[model samples]
Target: MEPTGSERGPARYEPGEGCVTTVVRVPVRIVVLVLVVPVRLVWDVLTAAGRVVNRTALRPLGRGLAWLWQTLIVRPLVWLWHTLVVAPLRWLWRTLVVAPAAWLWRWVLVPAGRGFGAAVVWLVRYLVVVPAQWLRTYVLAPLGRGLAWLARGLGAVLGALVRWIVVVPAVALWRWVLAPAGRALAAVVTVLVRETGAALGHCWRAAGIISRALGRCLAAVLRWTLVEPVRWVYRTVLTPVGHVIRDGLWRPVRQALRTARETVRQTRREIRRALFGAPREPEPARAVVPRREPGGSGTRTLGKTSGRDVPPPARG
Candidate 1:
């Protein structure tokens, strides 16, 4: 057993070593001295040999090879491609395709487009739009006016004929013959209408009375049948049961959901702590812990100063 931080000051272990040096540190030092030193020497030797080879032979050889490849192979290929492939193709394309296209665009296509477009516009205005406007103004407009005038004259003649032929005879017949007959018929119709009106008034009164009774009955039926049943169900069944379920079931469900949410939140916090390391707890001010020397001798340090902000010492 060891004396922990609160129980006692720091102490040394057997074999004249502290607890860390005896248990954890000695093997580490031995492994480093025994294994790491030779490996480091071998690595240094190999790297030195490599550096010497590079400086003496390999560097110049690689630089010469690269220069030779670039100057002989790469530069010639690039020059050949530029001279034989690129320049000839560019010249041929300029002479065969681009120059012809430019000439056609400059001389033929552009002039055709402009000239034809303007000619088509003028032809359209002259042959179609202007002719249509001229026909409408000169031929169709006068023809339409003449047709309207002839139509108005014909209508006036027809209206005068109708007035003389139909309306004059009809007025004469009505004034001489139909007026007396219509008066006699209207007198008889007046008497019959009075009698029919009296009868219809009685029928209307009876219908009004019956309709009032039926309307009252319909209102009563609706109230007793639909309204009372709905009211009873709402008041007795729905509201009471709704209250019971809300308080008994829904309230507990909400509380359980709230508790589960809080539990999940706490679990997430714990998981985050485990994954990302512990939360940075507020620290107290630092103090140094030094080893106790034997036989009242001056104190000696086996490791670095112990403080909150002291960086870790170098490794083995």
Candidate 2:
């Protein structure tokens, strides 16, 4: 039968039945998944392990970058501290040593310089100045004063000697000349007086002798010639004729006698008038001095002539 299609199909196991022989043949897709899943798991695990290995390989490079950053930023701060702070401490050490050395020189050395200057000044005064002053005062001044005193004394002595020697001799010579002249004048006066007295005495003696001789001669001549002749003539001739002549010529003779008397009287009067100026009128005649005899000295002696008295001669 090909059977009826349904029933005749292979023995016909019933739906429930047949040895239940289900020949479950899973599908091809399930089969393929089950096979491919383990392979996929293994691939994923291997890729994860490869990524971790790559990260580990880059770690050294990152560490090198961090170290370079720290070096650039921090090294300048440390170098600045050493320069500003540490160098100043070294300079301070040198300054401290030099300051102490300069102070020692100022305190110890200045006084020694002043002492040296004072010693030089003392040595110059003792060596030069003191000896010069002593020589001027003690030796030179005393010698000059002594020479001046000697010159003054010598001038005074010379002046006194000149006055005594010259003046005394001149006074003695004047007295010697005047005394001889006075004696000569006195002798001349005495001679002149003696000569005058001798001349007067000679004249008086000669005049007296001549007057006496003249008087005696005149008397003798008159008596002899005139008186004798007149007496003889009168006696002889004139006596007789006297009477006759007297009578005749008596008148004429008498007249003549009268005339003669008159003439004589007139002549006497004229003579008196001539000698003593005019005569006075006639009165009684006064007596004159009496005359001495002719032989005696006439009238009066020469000594008695008072109106002719001689005066004495004048003396020098």
Q: What is the C-alpha lDDT of each candidate?
A: 0.75, 0.58
User: Could you list the CA RMSD of all candidates, in the order they appear?
Assistant: 47.2, 99.9
lDDT of 2 by residue, 152-247 (tens): 788778766765666555555545754566555554444334333332333223232333344456666665677666666677767767977878
Error of 2 at 286 (Å): 66
Q: Per-prediction TM-score, please?
A: 0.29, 0.19
Q: How accurate locally is residue 69 in candidate 2, as Cα lDDT from 0 to 100?
A: 64
Give a tens-digit lDDT track for model 1, residues 1-316.
Answer: 5433433422343476334334444454444345444454455557779999999999999999999999999999999999999999999999999989999999999989998999999999889998899889989999999999999999999999999999999999999999999987786666456434533443334343444456679899999999999999999999999999999999999999999999999999999989998878799988988876664534335764445446778899
In candidate 2, what residue range of length 10 has the lowest lDDT sum?
1-10
Query: Residue 308's C-alpha lDDT in candidate 1?
Result: 44
Task: Pick the TM-score winner.
Answer: 1
